[model samples]
Target chain A: MTTERVDDATTLTDDERRTLAAIADRLIPAAHGMPSAADVVTDERLRFALNARPDLAEPLRQALRPELGPDLQARLDTLGADEPATLYALQLVIVGAYYTDAGVRDGIGYPGQVAITVRSWEYPQYLEDGLIDAVLARGPVWRDPATGTRARTDNAPNTYAERFGGTPPEGDTHGHDRA
Target chain B: MASEPADVLIIGAGASGAVVALRLAEAGFKVTCLEQGEWLNRADYPGNKLDWELKARKDWATSPNIRGLASDYPIVEDDTPVSPLMYNAVGGSTIIFAGAWPRALPSDFRVRSLDGIADDWPIDYFELLPYFYRTDKQFGISGLPGDPAYPPDTEDAPMPPLPIGAAGLKVARGMTKLGWHWWPEFNSINSTNYDGRRPCVQRSTCQSGCNEGAKASTDLTHWPKAIGLGATLITGARVSRIEHNDKALATGATWIDRDGAEHFQPAKVVVLAANAIGTPRLLLLSGLGNSSGLVGKRLMMHPFANVAGLFEEPLMSWAGQFGDLIESLEFYETDEKRGFVRGARWGLAPTGGPINTALPSRAGEQAWGPDHHLHVRSHLGHGANWGLFAEDLPDEANHITLSDTVTDASGIPAPEVHYRMSDNSRRMLDFHIERAKESMDAAGAYKIEVDRLMRYSGWHLLGTARMGDDPKTSVVDRWNRSHDVKNLYVVDGSCFVTSSGVNPTSTIVAIALRAADHMVETRFEQQVPA
Candidate 1:
């Protein structure tokens, strides 16, 4: 995404901010026990998303121009039908900022993605209760290409050294075999 | 005035190219690779950062037409239903792949022989079987063995299977309840510490890239090892076309750098390991290896769709390896009774974070006003999607051609795609979509949503330059040598004889390793430029 044509002039004027705020509220209103768009669509959050996608800055600015009328819902409908990219730009900025809001994420009881240290692998609880016993019992679904029948996978020689007539390298016999 | 030629020259550094470079270099051959894109730093992927979701919509988008980077080439895909998605980096499209590591089933090789439709592969599943074993360890694939989906693996995964988290558990329960086939999917992502890479923490941003380097993009899996064995890789060197001698043997390639400077790379043998579209485009541009007029024919991208189940329980669906939690091949084989010649494969994948729930980066449009929050709250962390990838059969009518009007930044003509979804693919997807919905319903979901025929789901680019015994129909032979040009090989997905109902990376690299091994076994007999 590092393109030469990216425009970095992102200092928004007061009028541009008002234009974006107006569109943001209509795109994501206050509902579903969540905070309003005003709480999430801050100038700072929008800028962060904008910086990550610098190529969108000029289009986003153009979308926030004085061309949009005050009838916000109707304006959105018009943009959705006529200028879809502009509407999409505004929507992307709003949704991006809304998720970044710490309060909103906390209120929703969702912590952002974080790395967890994996301990020794163990089968989860559900799998322990015969969940996949049926699958294991249904052996060897793959067909033999030569005969066009389900191959005898259980009784078949499982390695090159076995059926295909070659010796496997020393001590090699599992998914755990590292080259 | 030119430097001494290397033993082998590879025109890409993606999955197949990286593997060939590694294998040939290990065999003590002097190898050089030209990559259009530079190596990506694993840490720079948006998985760990704030505003990470937004990156998926813009910068990290899969379709190169959307990314608009200097490293990317524009594709004229207006005529096609599916876009040809690829990455031009050191690891290539593996940079953005989901790392689902399912090997092509045995039946997948003989589509023509078994089904009597497409042409049979000159080489069958057994030829590449040993290489798959070696390549699986090379990439550190994680999975449980003894699934009825395929022939049994001789050994267990080098590491343990990835934890099938809450979302996977629900989907697995549903599939098992129906007495259908489902198994913990084989993934190139690390489940435990293996191959010197950290285990996956399941951040679920796999499609964007693996920040923890848990997922095996070839840059991590093969390039470093290949370079260690003395394969010289030149980044920012976009190969314009394959160069050949008057004797019709490939010499090397003429490449253009980032600054628009041109240079000729000399080699005794040249390998075109670019993806299906890129390889065919390069060949078409150079006017080589198309004497059969099949260089850019028979394009096949898996006709892809998604079915999401919304449950009451907070599945925390956004918090795991998003690609291969569980896969079902219950309907993988063909059954003409279902009104289709072939079938589809299904994999359970976690839906993304809030922004993705509100407006999926690839899905078109979003709900606005009051309904926007409703859409967000209902799906944000409560859903798991079953990706339905139907096997798209090759049709000669569907193909890629060089665009007369379009070109890349370096002014190389962009490849134009002409793919039409077949009646078989359409019926296959329709039937699978309903079955997938039924599977979701079995999982105790309150509601199900279907995203049918998503345009951006065109990751599996294949079959444009297929391999066969017939020189009149195929681009490459069973050994992957171009029928028209000796010393020139195509070892990527381009040489796939048939499009299998699984991810192509494992098969691609495995076949490349087999080809590289063949080259080493018969090095003294290989033809080169005069």
Candidate 2:
């Protein structure tokens, strides 16, 4: 099956495009509701990278030559296993492009970029409300150097401990008390 | 070639050059700044664009070795593991820096006296304190007061620290658990609308240049002010060498413009604020400032590494400002038992954006295909990376010299950086790696990945033309005035006597301010001995 071209800036031939797509697919296979690299137009990203750094294109072209065989998977497997710098560069662009997709980012549960809109410069209320205390209660935690084996001494009213409350959970301090 | 005489001609329009220009011009001296790169406005900055990360990897890369723009000169960095990274622009490296604005510890000034390792700075922290305060106020620094890590001082940041994200909070708790001192990190970014600049909106791409002008890059903070105060800034003017008179004092500098036209700007005083590598290269080319035979010796790039901790919960590592929101200098002072003379400071950093995280590991680990997707899905948001900035001692072997073979677009010889991690640095890295792992473990991270061999981490380039009281041992004196060339001054990181473990921009600006103050007081009106 052929894919629609997303970018026309490349001088890559149809065979070269197919070879690149096959390699990209092998690099980032479809998984977890996310489209495979080839389906999501990663080839365009690869083409752009190749155009920018022309030195990478020849090695890729050589590695994916049809004379290397009709077996596309075998060609990709051989290329991947050989660990050429060209393969790494291709893999980088493929993966980078895949994640940059908004759909892919949402599918993977990443919030992407965010802007702080609150006008005031105060600390986030959640931190002061109870988050610090909750984290501290995950003890017996890493030992504070100033406090030694005991808990911190300067746990004032608005401090990490007092803000979240000073009660340790019953039984062992969970498995997180590594220190 | 326009041949107007200015009272002062600064070679670079970067960090120190901008500061000096502002101060000298404000003192009624005619100052002309010659910058090799173009003056970029907010529109020129890479804003919240979708391809911002690509911009960093391509056009706006911090290293000239990587970017190779026509405006940038090439450098031979193959000899050094950590490449000297900088941006050639009105603001220099600050245009691409993360703006982690930590001051050098007081002891950093007296390393030779206290630790008996590197030479002591000709000036001390106490002497530079007022300038530091001035710089902090100027930059509108954001930080929490009463950080137990620092020695008690009256100086407080202008604003509260940037909001500590979950990753920073987690790391702070981890440090607390490990019995270490951690505090809200000071940043050269405005937390609120200060002066005429807008507050930081947490764009998360400060390294790509702040389009909002929230970060205190000199172009945003000082250049416009200097220009308003009657300073002449000629961009695209690449200085080839400082021209000296028979009296051995610099009269002016000859530079090549963008059209390859050479112009000589005459000045009563010439200041070299062209960064560590650029300044020394020009001085050597001019055949001056080598009376001590130490023009480009004793280079230091603060050796650093990154440790990433993977957690089960999402911490949104890619969404906030890149500054170190939380940091620990508990190990910043000297500790003889660790088999090292000095220590390091580790700060909380994000695991980078999607593209950066998806890029293959520098250690040859493939982050591609189904395995790559699964790995990123499991770790991206859950990862918190720590940057460890360790002090690199001034070793004469680790130096920058003029390359005999390579030349830049200006037909000037490129800088050849020769550097290797000293034994002390290696030991410090090993120690810091272990400590970082412990901190991660304490933070309840299931897995920790440490890139101990950081090959691309040398952003803080320093100590090419060191300052001292003795002319036999140094290039410039305490006032940053060249010992050999009386009217010529070397300001910027090149005059740094020691490379502190923290970021050096704050210290660099403070030093420049102090030097400019001295120049205005004593020599602003002096004429060149024609």
Candidate 3:
């Protein structure tokens, strides 16, 4: 499937196409029932992107030249770490194209843009309610003042003082964190 | 060729220009508005398409240079730390704005007396309050009242505030723990169907133009009102130069039409609402309002940053309006001990779409291969982002000048912006980043990331031709009338004496209303200022 010649406006040589497919696969490899970038027709997307931004195609092709051998992942890792712009160019086309696929969105548990029904505004009670109690329970995340220790308190009006003890850092109220 | 004379001519049908046009037209004046870009219908918005996110990254991009639309003029931004981002449409940058409507604080106007750093505004906040209320009603602003962060006398928003989603709930709880003041954000978007426009359907694509006509861009509010009131609005009419008589009063302007034909419009009064960079560019090009040699000086771009958190639970931040709903202005005023004069407003933001999140982080941290897929999948609905709109003080060195080498399609010299974040701004950003991270941590975020400096978000362009009583130090007076060229006025962000610690759209519109009222009361059907 990866070897198939995808027809596009900007004609990429066979080697360029294969190299891009290999790079796309490495960038977003198929695993855990989710398809890889190549499986989501990234080659066709890249061709279209290249046709639109022709200036980026040559740099991408040049970036792939040194890594044209069997150890494609190693070269790609080096390129990704070393040449960021080239890697970003490749990743932008692949990731952007891959996410557009419905199967990929479903596989990744991304419920795409949902239509919102506008209604009268209401104060969301979930904040007062214990909807995020599980996360809050792992608290005492804020630091203490005199004790120099992290402490947690129930989400109450005077929670900051009850938890931290000894007056919160004055100045910018937020400066307490830096202190 | 010369055209028929009008009672009033306004340049750029943007936030300020549109309001001025509507108000003047309502005052029975023959008003003509020239806009550089065409009117974009709600149907033309990319939010209606499946590839909406893709369009946001390309054709409908916020940066004119990146979008490269025929309507966009080039900007040379090599010297600036952040590139200027704007849209050249009937509604201008408001088309891409997040509808974050925050008025400048009363202290913001008295910065010189309060902070002793920036100069004071010629007109104080009280003078602009009525206009604010009027424009808020027009925009159908939705917000909560009695936010302890603002001054006690602050008026309540017209419409009820938008719902604070799960992510906002987390942040609110976190702020409560930290004892920080947080409130529902004031939005220009309609909470319920009001003024013939639909309510925000929470598409989370406010930056890509609102498809539902919920977001109050001028095209939906002022433009239609102005047109209904018999105002002549010519789209695709780029004003090249402001024409003036021997006495140095503004006659009108010379503009280039869509077909590249030249036109000279003569008006009794001319208003330049062509934004900060644009207004200065025209003034300098035509040699209109440079008597004080400060036409394009003191450019300010609100330096900003974002702090993101990965939560254990599904926050589903991508479901609602992206940058609306909640904000914290606890740190809005100045604090001498914090090492910065003006502070920033922390607002809730989404983690963006799938592709944008999957891309390498600002610090160049890439989550790749099988591990990348797993990482992204796990973080899909479990992320929230908060942003800071920090104040960048006006500096004469940081300004807009005409680039001798760069010219746009119309052969007009492109604006070359030269700006660098001041030490004060850097200190403010550092504090903001720390506070944002602390809030995220308090929200139970296991993995936290901060883009210490937002280099690509130059949304608020202000203070080029600022308002001041001193003509030697300012371009316009208290009424937004150019001191050097009397009948000529500047009603945009260009007239902002100081860039406040918030979005300037609401204030921009309000200032325009106030300026128009002044014009009608004092100068309507009267002789041009001599």
- Among all windows of 10 consecutive residues in model 1 chain B, the one with the lowest summed lDDT is B357-366
The residue pairs in collision within model 1 are A174-B155, A175-B155, A175-B156, A175-B157, A175-B158, A176-B157, A176-B158
Q: List the residue pairs that clash in candidate 3.
A: A140-A151, A140-A152
* Stretch of 10 with least lDDT, candidate 2 chain A: A169-178
Docking class of 2: incorrect
What DockQ does each prediction reach against the true complex?
A: 0.40, 0.17, 0.19
> What Cα-based lDDT does every candidate model obtain?
0.82, 0.77, 0.78
B360-425: candidate 2 lDDT, tens digit per residue: 654445565667677777777788888999998998888888999999897889989999999899
Per-candidate RMSD, Å: 4.3, 7.2, 8.4
Best by TM-score: 1
lDDT of 2 at B252: 91
Which interface RMSD values do the candidates have, in the order shown? Answer: 4.8, 11.3, 11.7
Cα lDDT tens digits, model 3, B1-530, are 98888889999988899889988999888999889999887787777666676567667788888887888899999998898888888998889999988788777787777777888887877778889989998777876544444433345576656667788888878877876767668888876667888777777889999988888899988888889989999889988899888988889999998788999988989999889989999999999887778888889889988888888888887767764658877677777899878888788876667877787776556798789877787676677788888988989999889999999888889999999999999999899889889998998999888888877789898999999888888899998988888889999999888898888898999999999999999864555624
Model 3 off-target regions past 4 Å?
A1-7, A42-86, A121-123, A126-179, B152-155, B524-526
CAPRI quality band, candidate 1: acceptable
TM-score of every model?
A: 0.94, 0.89, 0.88
What is the fnat of model 1 with respect to the true interface contacts?
Answer: 0.64
